[model samples]
Target chain A: MTDRVIRLQEAPFDYGAECAAFAERAGGAGAVVTFLGLVRNDGGSLTRMEIDHYPGMTEAAIDAIAAEAATRFRLDSLLVLHRTGPMQPGEPIMMVATASRHRAEAFAAAEFLMDYLKSRAPFWKKEHRAEGPIWVAARDADEEALDRWAGGAG
Target chain B: MRVLYFAWVRERIGRPWEDVETTAATPAALADELAAREERYAAAFADRRALRVAVDQRLVDFDAPLEGAREVAFFPPMTGG
Candidate 1:
């Protein structure tokens, strides 16, 4: 089976390179779906953001998450990348690419992977504003997003 | 034992990470030990309502035994990508 997960640092990611990697690994796949989550300006209000992650634990968590997504959606391939350390506005924070024989599985898996990554990964974001450095609160919306995918075995 | 904090939990506690020797055996016991360290850890865990625990690298309940666990991590509900 093709490797179905990618997780790494907060460095610049090449969309083209990721696409090529997916194409090379995905044999006989008819569809590929990808999602990119950028560090938004958040309406130009925020100043800076810092992402923290456990060294070994972070990768393990992402890998487990990716593996689960692949199984649940029966995907042909999956790629997930998460950045750590300081990030400025408009930078890429993470990406998820999914490949499958059909559009349904690819799309669902990509979306599901993103949702699960947001709520389950070992990432912590701290925001800087004009006022001062303020750590962000975990949102209720995030939990609700993950809840949409509940009932599948852990 | 080593106690690690992530994200805002680190901020509230005023440190990103700390290592403390504990007589406690499990993650929950470690948490209690930390909570007793000072007001900072206590306040950091003031409302465990949104906090999450992980032993080694896998997520587990607070009460999950820490047998043979080398590392324990405490943090808020994840808000990753």
Candidate 2:
């Protein structure tokens, strides 16, 4: 059975603690990989970032993504944690962790989760700049990243 | 059905969600009905290519059937990471 943990919260998360707990729970897995996304100030004028998400849909979308990753990669465990609401530039926005019996499977699952989170999840971001707040546009690169995994084996 | 909006779409439409009663059979038909209601919706949905739709929390094409769908959400491409 594949273990899964998914969380969407407004408060900050403890990355180190979460990692340690996940490692403990994933016991005996040969490989574990973790990816963390941080808010970036592309224009150097970004003062804050705000995330808006559909309350009922966000968790459902992430759960479906995690389930797909587990089946495709034969993962032993998977964890996805994302933050919403106002945040600073240096704060952690999200994290994905995966465990598998092999390094390749673990790495691939983590990347897959990240790609889905970037484009498929129902979350929107707005950057609060020194001048004004602007909604961030979805990038073609992110879409391409997700498309690469389509109809492919783990 | 309940129609929901997010991001810039919500800003432009001036609300988060609304309850609508329509005879539309598909998301595209519903879009047409909403667009005809007011100018703000027309402008928000002016470019179908720029918007994405979800029926019952699953992403689908505009032509996807909305039969028995309790919720329909329209928003721009997701920018989550």
- Candidate 2 lDDT over A40-117, as tens digits, reads 988699999999998888988998888888788888999999999999988899999999999999999999888889
RMSD values for the candidates in order, in angstroms, are 2.1, 1.7
Candidate 1, residue A104: the lDDT equals: 94
Q: Candidate 1's C-alpha lDDT? A: 0.80
Pairs clashing in candidate 2? none
Best by TM-score: 2
Model 1 chain B is weakest, by summed lDDT over 10 consecutive residues, at: B16-25
lDDT of 1 by residue, A33-108 (tens): 8888887766577788888787888788778777788678867888887788888888788888888899899999
How many clashing residue pairs are found in candidate 2? Answer: 0
Model 2 — interface RMS deviation? 2.6
**Candidates in order, interface RMSD in Å:** 1.5, 2.6
Model 1 clash number: 1
lDDT of 2 at B65: 88
Tens digit per residue, CA lDDT, model 2, B1-81: 999999999999999999999889999999999999999999999999999999998899999989999999999999898
